[model samples]
Target: MRISRRQFGTLATASAAGLMVPGLAQAQSATGMHSFAAPAPGKNTHPLLAKRDQNAILARIQGLMKRDGVGALVIVKPENVAYSTGYVSRFAYGPGVPAGSQAAAVIPASGNAQLFINLMESDDAPRMTDDVDVTAMPGFVFVDDGTPESRQERSATIDPLAGFKDALAAAQDMASDGKIGIEKGSLLAGLLAYLNSQVPEDRSLNSEDLLYEARLIKTPWEIDILRMAAQHAERMMSRVAQQLEPGMNALVLENMIRAAGWAEDKEYSMSNMAFQIGIGPYWGVSGSNRNYEIKQGDLMRIDGGGTHFGYISDITRTWAVGGSPTSKHEEIYDALYAGFLKGLELLKPGVKMSEMYAEVRAEVEKSPLLPTYARGHVGHSISLSPLLEDHPLFAPGFDVEFEPGMCVSLETSYMAAEGSYAPGPYNIEDSFVITESGYDRFTTVPDSLVWDGSLTTQ
Candidate 1:
């Protein structure tokens, strides 16, 4: 199973298993946007999507269209592309981060959803999603290669400009002479130049914030998928904990987690995995090159994650190399844990991100285990992308409020012991879904620094 790229906390607790179902009264097209009403909750509208809450989805689309000073949207980022079309991108930009990929989703304020992709997925991409119309670009195909039986996909080669002309035409139709809202941060300069060549410069703007804000709120169906994703994340984390030993290489552990996920029947479209390896203080973000070793007392922190069902899970856990966390280890964990609890306690609908950060930081500052500096949100809206996505990051003036169907990570970290990777902070993260009253957690890992000492010897 492939891991697809794919949060916590209101103190108000709800049954983690009891999903908060919302009744979407169809796509309200009163504002002249695409009106799509998802199938009733608990439905299999597509191969992977069990719920197609069109109302929830259209609400986001409407939000983006209604962004002040914006008139239309061109969603090209992998995260947003998947969000609208349910077409998880198999495209990889590599370490160099290419300027553009041959994929996009053109969403008009008052029509249908148009998903553009490489030629490779043209044949079956529509089968992977619901609602949106799929348009595969030219010159590539989604393939599995490098081996005979049960071959694995390396990646698809793309003609950077393929189908872009047609895509621009679609965007033009959506824009309908309105200011074109492009993904400025990601819709590369080349693409932008091309788009600008076609449209009036005065009629374009960066609508990243609008798209992000729209994506922040999840529908009941999306929440269910996120919940499943979190469980898969815990399984991967548990594998690392269970197989952890004094002599295994980081590569081995990486493969172990991947295998464990497949063993659990987890399948995803695109995902990446990297971890900080080596003994404490020497931690470095190492790949699975098979060189780094895990010493008896090394604190191996996995700062990176992969995807599941096109939705990435942001779960970080620092394990004591030999298990049975020492008092010193516990102290560091406690400091970070303080923020986790405070984040949860203060997390309710209408609560500001700034407020959450201030309160959580107040508690985190109480711990001597931390360094002098601290920044970032105690929690951030999560879905599709794992980092500070959906305009996440509780900085000053982030006036957004927690809303139902929103998911976030109750994230916290600290510098346990410094060395080559001086002041490397211990990473602790989990997922939660905001609901009608409280929230629903995705990961079930224990929230304490303590793990059974006996597991070290397993």
Candidate 2:
């Protein structure tokens, strides 16, 4: 179901008042952002999957298909397949897996959906969602017990091509007017050739644009997942920040961040923890070096993220190592924060991303302290991708307007020259969900130049 603007406004108000939606209360209580009870167990499904509105997502896809005059979509990208079918495949995680062995989802614009997956995952994939008709293909040889059910479920061929042909025929039958959209980049050459021979070239259109368009505006369920992911990352970062002390190298800090996240059964993503000490142009460096020790007054800049379910969180913060910030340090941070706040102020429905970028860039350029400050983009959309930055970046020439239910990250950074007076990187970043009137921020850590030791005190 789509959330009306009025409903969204009320929900935003409730969220601000610390009354979060179901399935998020436990995270809120753990982070002290809100008072809530633990979520109850889901029946035969992952908690996040139980929270997802599959109907809403399918309706969105159908709407986009109707608008584009497309009939059906053959989704094969690991991320896209997961988004459409709610079945996270193990093949997407490790290396050396054949391209043809990947799972695919055949979604019709006006009817039931079909998921083509490996037979080994047949039992688990159905538990994630019951909205799709699963077609399990033979992936590995198994010594099955002589049971009637096992014999009936077994496929005749182990060839992936045979399964692809079956799925393609099914998609054609479901197509509205013989027009199908396929992800060429994710398909094997043999599969693509077969698709070409079966369907005319004009009828087989690229599904990338259509799929991305549908995913651009998130449903209410997606927003909740993003919010929870952001909170998880912030909590881990806070713990790591509190442990910072003299002589602690990047290795130590990185381990702390990983340990904190893994302890809660979450995964790290997107540079994990890119750290920089004192000065230089190593803004995106994440390698752990024992020689690069954090000194008493060194500036520490950390840009990192963690993943929840599949949503990603990208957050950055810079501060003095020992709670002692020099005048120059504070001045630089003030400039960055000013620009960040300007971006936040401009983050509302109907605002163009490029317009926001220009305004924020102008605000930061006004500061005399950062005469050399420059950036290509201030922020980007954050979601299911393994990469931190998604599409429609907050950069010049991107004219996508902010819409309610869109979640994005707003960030800006400055790295002074090696011998400059205020040397080192100064940065700030946070995630937010665009609302009806304004935006709801995800991270709650204070934007301070010095760590207040709040985590330690608690």
Candidate 3:
């Protein structure tokens, strides 16, 4: 459905107009400042898929498809499909990423491509991609006897999996014995079972590595949008600072912080934009419940982002609500800052992604209060999804090297409590990218938590 410009404006940041009181409980009037214009919408005018980086993607897929000797590549992963076709599917999330019967854009050895989608999605799927040609097939359609004998008719109806099954059947009908590459991770169990059950003896089915490999590097346009996302996030951080105070509900604070992001006018159409807010001791993670009442000495963590064009932007900041932070609070905050700087110092093109993670880990270990629990990995690569490089080089799992265009999350977590040896953990995550010398931080939140010292009298 086309969201009216007015509706889109509300969803964007246009709603955050005037300055309001600092704390949620009090009814103090805010002084209008030249700075608070409520963020304008973003300026990204195009969709990521509209750019059609398909040739590069196709080249990457060719090797995998050829290695598997697959004639047709049937992709079902939402991120995979978006990467391949620039078609971000909102439907993918509705039924969960894996369970949906979303069909892949069919890439044959030499003919045109076709996209198969569910009957319900027949209308919505076409708008997803501006580049590739698309066709919709219902679960099944049949021809009944008509008054005229000379004309043979065609009818079709679709099952949930009809889109995927039809694409496969079509492929097989054209080339019976050719290999079909299926993204095993994406194919639902039921769909896999059906494919296994119905496949003819002549055809060979196997999993292929086409989509995963293409996601490793991002295009220039993708990088540009990610940068724009960071800019919006930085603006959101400032908005949160103005609203930081004691007594604000977690949800209210979160909604306000996100509203600040929407305040900026978007130049392009953003796809899959997301925002998160965590108050109190938890700075980075939002599982701490929405709108937890802001308490004295509580640190407020506001994280938010909107896509640049279609490239995702994810960034975060932590603020000290009410007055100036205590000495101990400052120490804990400083420790995180140090860790962030350490990570950034090591983040650069040609540097091993693991080396940067190790630097952060080493710095954290040097602190007087050694963490009992394993601190999660420092950062990750993100292009399609917000957290692409979640695993650190030092951590077990994927170890991807840094390249020029890849974006990353430089996050730090630490725990501190007054009078107690075991301090609760506080985390702050921000978006950054590898540069020639080191890296550039996208978030503009104050590196140190600001406490205004004393309360103001009216």
Better of 2 and 3 by lDDT: 2
Model 1 shows how many backbone clashes? 21
In candidate 1 the C-alpha lDDT for residue 442 amounts to 72
TM-score, candidate 3, is: 0.73
Clashing pairs in 2: none
Q: What tens digits encode model 3's per-residue C-alpha lDDT throughout 1-458?
A: 12233433444333244333223111111232223233224322144334556566556665566666677766666666666666665666455645337555666654545566554555555664544566664533332336563244434533667677777776666444567666665576888877777675446554534555556566665666667677766665665565555765564554454444444333434443466555565435544346367686676655546655345666666666775566776777676777777877777877676676777877876766544325667777766654434323334344566776667777776545444542434666777766667676665445677733121111
Candidate 1 lDDT tens digits, 312-428: 666666777676555666677777777778888866888888888888888888876554436655566777773434467665677778887788877776554444123434767
TM-scores for all candidates: the values are 0.76, 0.81, 0.73
CA shift at 358, candidate 2, in angstroms?
0.8
Angstrom error of the Cα, residue 339, model 1: value is 2.4
The per-model lDDT (C-alpha) reads 0.61, 0.70, 0.57
Deviation of model 3 at 178, angstroms: 6.3
Residue 160, model 1, lDDT: 77
